[model samples]
Target: MIAKRLVIAGVGIAAVLGGTAVVLDQVTAGQSADSRSAPVAGSSPTASGSGADPGTADAATAAEAGGAATAEATGAAAKPAEGSASAPAGREVLPAVSPSPSGLPMPPPPAPLISLPLPATASAQGKIVDGFPADVIAFPEGTVVVSTGVSSAEGSLQISADAIAASSQASVVGHFQQILGPLKFWSEPVQAAEGQQSMRFSRGNDSVTLTTSTTGTGSTRFMLLANLHAAAGG
Candidate 1:
């Protein structure tokens, strides 16, 4: 009886082994078929992993890996380096300009220019003398009176004047003519020689003699001698 039970057990084990072999073959065949058809359908590789064939699952895994690699490469290409320069977009940038200094000190002004005559007295350097007939003889504007004198002798007034004018000889002569003409002073013919002139005028008891000469700097130097006698009274 022991021998019979042993034989029966052996047959049962053989049947189980045969069934397992058949199941393994079917699985391998289905996998081969899926692999052949996977490329045609183009969708099986993306399916879920639970019930997929081994070949399909392996292909899906490879596809996912390749996609991940492609994504990684794209991201790397898109990203910029840590210190790399960026692309310029709109207007060009220019360098900044610095302003010039404005607070520097200025130089001092120059001294005034004064032309003084030689032999000028201290009291009459640039002013008219007292007791001189100012209304009858109008000195030109800006005339510098260098010397002046007033004296009385024999009940008559005598005045002497020396002055300088920044004017031409002709201009000074014209000025005196204009002044004495209106006062009915008869003027003698002028004596002129090489930038020198002498003029004499007489009205009633008053007589004026003027001598003018041109200086080297285009100025006129003049000397005046006048005598005035008091008019007759009732």
Candidate 2:
């Protein structure tokens, strides 16, 4: 009975030691797992930290990618407006015009008429002492005569002729008679030269002495004569 009691006490002491060893091993394993799972206070984890979650890291990476893409799109949208603002302003374009020529049409000139010269014979013998060739006479037979005379204040008359022809007396006398009406003369024809004639006429106190002669022939022939003191003081 004493030996059986001692054996039972030793078995009890062995079972208690085994159980304590098992409990110590379990506590050590739990301490190792806790150290691996928990982060240290006030310490940042590295990229390779065992405490970091893969899912959380992937979500952070996706957020960063989305931010970059948004930035790029914003820049693209603003690029066109910036480019247009920096460009130059537009202008209205027009073509250049030139001047016209100065050359144009103009007007024409005028016509010229015939004029006769004054005589010198009357100026030498008259009181007024100035004379001009008055009328030019032409005959159908081609003769021309230029008459020259002088008149005094006392109604004295001196007449002379520049005969263009010795013939053509009738042609010269006819033309002289035709112009006589305009000269305001009344006269009877009197022979003065071999082929010439003279006429005398008067108006008021004034007297006229005329001498006519032939010159040239045909249409170029004419007669010239003088009427002096026909108009008083004229």
Identify the leading candidate in terms of TM-score: 1
Q: For residues 99-193, write the lDDT of model 1, one tens digit per residue.
A: 88889796543221111121222235456776666887878888988888767655566778899999988898889989988876688857767
Q: Cα lDDT of all candidates, in order?
A: 0.75, 0.51
Q: Write candidate 2's Cα lDDT for 19-132 as tens digits.
A: 999999999999999998787765447534756666677789999999999999999986776434343457654556787878886533211111223233453321122442
Best by lDDT: 1
Where does the lowest 10-residue lDDT sum fall in candidate 2?
109-118
Summed backbone clashes in each candidate are: 0, 15
lDDT of 1 at 57: 76
Task: Give lDDT: candidate 1, residue 175.
Answer: 90
